[model samples]
Target: MSDPIVPPILPREFGVYFALLEVSALVQHGVEGQLRRDGGLSFVQFQILAILGEDPSSPRSMTDLADRLVHSRSGLTYQVDRLEQAGLVARVPSEQDERGVNVTLTPTGAAVLARVLPGHADEVREVIVDALDGADRDELTRLLRQVARHLRSRPPRSARRAPTRSAEA
Candidate 1:
C-alpha cells in the first residue's frame, strides 16, 4: 500500500476550531438517541422546546426562534409544525403585532421537557461535561462565549441569561 497521506500545515488556531467541530458533532450524536427515545423529539425539535422552556410563560416569535436557532424560517416552521401536530406547542397571534405569530409550549410540551431534561443532563455529563473538571468546564464555557460574542452569531436582543436549572428540571 502507498504511504499514508500527510496533511498540509494549518494555523495553530485551527486545532481549536476542528476540536470544537468534532466535539459538537459527537455530543449531538450522543444525545440524539436519548432525546428521540425519551421525548419522541428530534434535536432541533428538542431545542425549540428547550428554548421555550427557558421562559414557558412568555411567548417567543417565530422570527426570534429562527434567528436564535440559526435556522431558516422554513426549517423552523417545519419543526414547529411537527410539534404543533403532536400537541406539544401552539402558535398564537402576537398581541404586539397583528401579523406576527408566537410559539408557546403547551402543557404537554412542558411535561415532555421536564421528562427529558434529566436524562439529557446525564447524557451531556457522560459525553462532555464529565470530561472536564469544574474549572475547566467553566473555562470552556467562557472561551465559547468569547468566540460566540466575536462571531456575533448570538444576538443580545434575542439572548437572555437562562437561570440555572436543577437536574430534576
Candidate 2:
C-alpha cells in the first residue's frame, strides 16, 4: 500500500502557529475568568454589551451583531434572549425593516460595562500588552491584522455545502 502524501510545515511556520494558538487560548481563558468572577458575565455576554455600548443611540440588528462578533445567528439570538431576560439589553423591531429585530444596550447594561471595563482592561494588559514593548506591540498588531484580513476574505469551510451522492447507478 502507498503511503498518503502529506505536506510538510516549515519549522518556523509550525512554531508561529503553535505560539498563536497557545497565546490565544491562555489570553481568552484569563479574560473569561475575570469576566465571570468580577463582572457576573460570560465573555460572550460582555462582548455583546461592549458592542451595544459602542453606540447607545444606534440599535444594531441581530444579523449585524452576529457578523461583527463572528457568531452564528442562532447562537447570537440565544445570547440576546438571555441578555434581554437580565435587563441588560432590549430588543425592538427595526424601523427600517419590520421583519428585522434590533438590539440596544440598556442603561443597566451600560453601567455594568462601565464597571467591568477597568478590570477587563487590566487583565488584558497583564496577559498581553504589558508583556511586549510599544514597538513590538504595534508590529504584532499590524501583522495580526494582515493575517485576519486574509482569513476573513475567504468563505468558512463549514459554510460550504458537501457533495451529494447520485441516485442513478
Candidate 3:
C-alpha cells in the first residue's frame, strides 16, 4: 500500500485536524484513566452519566439522549444498552411517545457519578482549565464555538438528496 497523503501540506487551516486529534487523545486518556480508577466507567459512559446527572429531567427519550450526546441514534442505543447491562442505566418506554424509549441513570449510576465527579472535575481542570488563565480560556471557548458553528453549518455529503430515477427506467 502507498503512504497516505500528509494533511498539513494543505493551505487551509488543517491545523484544526491535528489539534482535534491531539486534544481528543489527551482528553480521552485523562477521562478514561479517571473513570477506570474511580468509577469503572469508560469515557463515553461517563459522558452519558454526566449529562443525565446535570439535566433536571432525569429520564429522557433515547432519541433526545442521542441528540444531546452528539451520537448517532443507533450508536447511542448500543451505548445505552451497555450501560443498562452494567446496571448504570435503565431504559423505559416513554409515556409521551410510545415509539420512543426513555433512558435514566439508575441509583447505582447516580451514586457512582456523585462519587467520581469531583475527581473527574479535577482531572479536567488540570488538563484543560488550569493550563490557561481565565481570560485565555474564555477567548479560546468563544473562538472554538465560532469554528464549530461554521463547521456544523456545512452539510455532510450524505445529507444532500439524491436525484430521483424515472419509473420508465
Candidate 4:
C-alpha cells in the first residue's frame, strides 16, 4: 500500500487548530447540557427553533434550513419530524415549488424559545463572552470570520460532484 500523504502543518498553526477544536467542543458540550436540562431541547433542535423564530411569519424551505444550519438533509428531516410531533414546528408544502417543503416555527416553539433564550444567553456569556475582553473578542471574531469565509467559499463535500473514472485515470 502507498504511504499516507500528510499535509504540512506548522507547529503554531497546529496549536491554533487544537485550541479551536478544544474550545469549540467544550463550549458546545456546556451549551448542549444547559439546553437539555433547562429547555428539554437538543443543540440542533434549539438551533432550528432559533432560526425559525428569527422571522416567525416567514417559512424557510427545508433546503435553506439545512444549508443555514449546516445539517444533512436527512438529519434535518428527522429533527423536523420530532419537532412536528411535539407541535413545536410545522411543515407546509411550498407553494413556489410543489416538491419543496417549508418549515415554520409553531406558537409552542416560539414560546419555548422565549423561555429558553435568557438562559441560553447567560450560558453563552458565561462560556465565551465573559472569558474574552473587548479587544480579544474583536480579534477572535475577525480571525474566525476570515476562516469561515475561506471555508464557506468552497462547496461542501456532499454538494461537490465526484470525479468521473475517466477524469481519475
Q: Could you tell me the TM-score of candidate 3?
A: 0.79
**Per-residue lDDT tens digits of candidate 1, residues 6-48?**
6675657679778899998999998998999999999999999
lDDT of 4 at 62: 85
Q: Sum up the clashes in candidate 3.
A: 0
TM match of model 1 to true structure: 0.83
TM-score rank, highest first? 4, 2, 1, 3
How accurate locally is residue 123 in candidate 4, as Cα lDDT from 0 to 100?
A: 96
Best by TM-score: 4
Q: Tell me how far the alpha carbon of residue 147 in candidate 2 is from the true structure, in angstroms, after superposition.
A: 1.3
Task: Judging by TM-score, tell me the better candidate of 1 and 3.
Answer: 1
Off by over 4 Å in 4: 1-7, 156-158, 161-169
- What is the per-residue lDDT of model 2 for residues 40-136, given as tens digits with 9 covering 90 to 100? 8888899999999999999998877887778887888899998899899999989999898899999988998998999999999999999999999
Model 1 clash pairs are none
Tens-digit lDDT track of model 4 for 39-67: 78999999999999999999999888887
Clashing pairs in 4: none
Error of 4 at 151 (Å): 1.3
